[model samples]
Target chain A: MKKTTLFDIISPVMIGPSSSHTAGAVRLGLLAKHIYKNTPKKVKFTLYNSYAHTGKGHGTEKGLLAGVLGLDVDDRRIKDIFNSDIAKNIDYTFSYADNFKKHPNTVDMVFDDSMFVSGESVGAGEVAIRKINDFNVKLTGRYNNLILVYKDKPGMISQVTNLLQKEGINIAFLNCDRNAKGQEASMIIEIDGKMNTSIEDEILKIPDVYFVTYVEKLEN
Target chain B: MDTFEQLYKECLTKNKTIYQAAQENMAIEADISVDKVRSFALKSLFEMKEAIRSGLISKELSMSGMCGQDCYKVQQYYKKQNSMFGKLFEKIIEYALATSEENIRMGRIVACPTAGSCGIVPAALIAISEEYNCSEFEQINALITAGEIGRIISLKVALAGAVAGCQAECGVASAMAAAAVCQLRNGRVSQILNASALALKNVLGLTCDPVAGLVEVPCVKRNPFLAVHAITAAELALCDVESKIPLDEVVDAMGQTGALMSPMLKESSQAGLAVTKTGLKVQKQVFD
Candidate 1:
């Protein structure tokens, strides 16, 4: 029910056997790439349910790799990604699972043997980044956002938002998810507009905020 | 914010056309100028044309080899016999087939509402524009009108076959194409909305049953069929034939119909034609 754009309805020229399986797979890869903030030397994809069953016929695998390699959805090179030079440099493997608990079109992108970002192709080429590592977080790329992984503690939210208030940035939406009390937690704050590297640096300067990722808004 | 009635009232209050209101609405939403929205739209239009051009020539099968160059066959057939439906009809069918075939082959395509339903709007708009010599601005207006209709309906139902069956994809796409073509021919707001209503009402409970779970078979061929379907609705609306149910009510009905629809028929490919004997055989031939 958001103010849907003509682009949302009529655009995003893409390579397709499907929008959700192909384009949306590419977007999930892109989001995973953004979250890691670096290309992994090794990666593994765990596709679940429908994606696991029909991904190959749909070029879902190609789109997923092409996206992590920084290809846009429309790139014709997506169809030949297995033979593409970009995918050759990295170690990548795909495993399928049947998980009714997950959405029908869902995957977990495990980067560099450790970082795991789970997401779902909700529908219509739209996606949601649901969990990072083990924390339940929401990153939809609907806005310019920050994902702060820190030791969970009181006053961390206020500390982060107070810095934004000083920089004249407004928090449009925010969510906090933690592993346990006083342990590893993440604050996913979707902000109004562009935030420079200085904001990330400022957030990192906080005592318990060890990691920060500035996620750009999604193109599709 | 979701219904056609709101958009209609907004259009009337501002004395702006549906296209104008859509443009203004997009500009406001994205915090950009209307020119940028129009520019982006024109880019999509060009890409749609490019997809058709490529598809008319290529014979690339889908990854599963279930569908591929059916469009080329249609073009060849048209050249030989000339279509019984006449020039515009031939153009509509050929362009629709061309674009959807292009999509299944992994060629570039604009997802007008979605990739599975991409062919309808462009097939209608391009056929008319090429035949009638409509200007680029007029084409943009038609696309904007189509987009607005899609946007309003999407507010009620997510425009995905997985969410709401083919009614949300090809069915809504047919309605969007009707609105676009109606606008291109200078039908006013009322007629445009009615065209959309008629197209949607006719396709209620249309399922998403692509054999082999690919956007081929029914999807590619459905493009040409539904592109022509839009024409019927547009023609009736042009003659001042109003829909029994209004546009807003039609969209609401579509939403309710989608909810009432069995999940098996809504792109799960578990029931309907997807699980037919031939469908299972193709699924085996492709995936097994």
Candidate 2:
């Protein structure tokens, strides 16, 4: 069928030494980082299916640790990350899970904190960040602009877009997921433009917004 | 749009059969430039040497220079738990095992253009870079050249795990290695790609079936051999020995050969090492 996008079609940097282990682990880790934001006081990373059974062998444990530590997939620091100070901040464990919706290479990461996120590494370093702290959101790690976690309020979608439009930022793709009206919701806006700190600050000012995070594509 | 299909059509027209184009594209990311390749490769080499010097990667484990059972020009960095390669060697083994888990999770594996021999290219390239102090930008460029070579092989022969077994894995890795080396030597794109295709075509139809289905056995040990082969293949191609076989035709032959192979020959753990008494016993032990 349909031709996959560059991000969709090709991803050179992956878990390391292998696309699945190095790159996928990194993606899964990045998702973990995105959702958790601040390092988890403690991380009960249960590797379900393939992750739990083979995590330690695959460096998934170290990779997962590095991802939580906010390391890129290609960062050689990832190899040494386990011994770093950032690593000491969080306590971690690895286990496998057999049942999951996405892929066998699935990992169900649980952060023992107020906010949590879970994701799947489908393959080729492609990741689907499924749930963040129980808020139902699905996004590929390829989002180049802003990440919005908020409550589902009327006009909230356009409100976020208008702010970006006024800032001279072009929206490449906008994905929004709402669990229930007036409850919790999430939006991932991929922009053709870079986001400065002001854009992030303005978004956080919104009443229903919980928190905001932005990742630059070239950073990886 | 038409230009995109040109690569695919050439692969098919020349009788070169590949696993999937979408998969091959995984190696063509924007960051994988010539400079990046040199940086990564040299960094990898430097790291390997540092590990050895600092007693991280172990001399026995890292001091690979052996010919193995299957291929003639094969070289392995370390034996399976033999010698005093010690902790670092053990760590590498552990990392090799984890790679399988990573592959299963990541949706589209490039195999770095190879599913079976995926670990070798990166390991070797990175290890070499580490030992030599190459920059990241340089490593990325070498990788780009290697990726192009791998793509050429996908067009020329097979990069699949099942077709040529570990030969395809290690063999193509060597080919990619050769291309990378050629590029490092300031060779042009055509020379690098040709070298890669030649390296792969020369070893087409190697089989899979890791002993006991573990990424260890031949998997872990095979990397160094491919790493060296990559060097040799690059050197040979650089010397301008005409292989005569167009890259596409050879890849097609690899595909046909793979299709003709018994299921055991694939990564299925059914044949070869998987059937040996020790293989069966180890497999049973793992499951038990």
lDDT of each: 0.89, 0.56
DockQ score of the complex predicted as candidate 1: 0.81
User: How big is the positional error of residue B68 in model 2, measured in Å on the Cα after superposition?
Assistant: 15
How does the DockQ of candidate 2 come out?
0.08
lDDT of each residue in B2-116, candidate 2, tens digit only = 1223554654565432212322343354335434433443443343333223322222210011111222111133343343644433333333223322332222223455444
Query: Which residue runs of candidate 1 sit more than 4 Å off their true CA positions?
Result: A1-3
- Using lDDT as the measure, which candidate wins? 1
lDDT of 2 at A144: 68
For model 2, how does the per-residue alpha-carbon lDDT over A106-176 read when each residue is reduced to its tens digit? 66677775556677766545567767765656566665647787887788888888888898888877778
* Candidate 1 chain B worst ten-residue window by lDDT: B1-10
| Tens-digit per-residue lDDT, B97-158, candidate 1 | 88998898888999998999888999999999888899999999999999999988988788
Question: Which residue pairs does candidate 1 place in steric collision?
Answer: none
Worst 10 residues of 2 chain B by lDDT: B59-68
> What TM-score would you give candidate 2 relative to the actual structure?
0.64
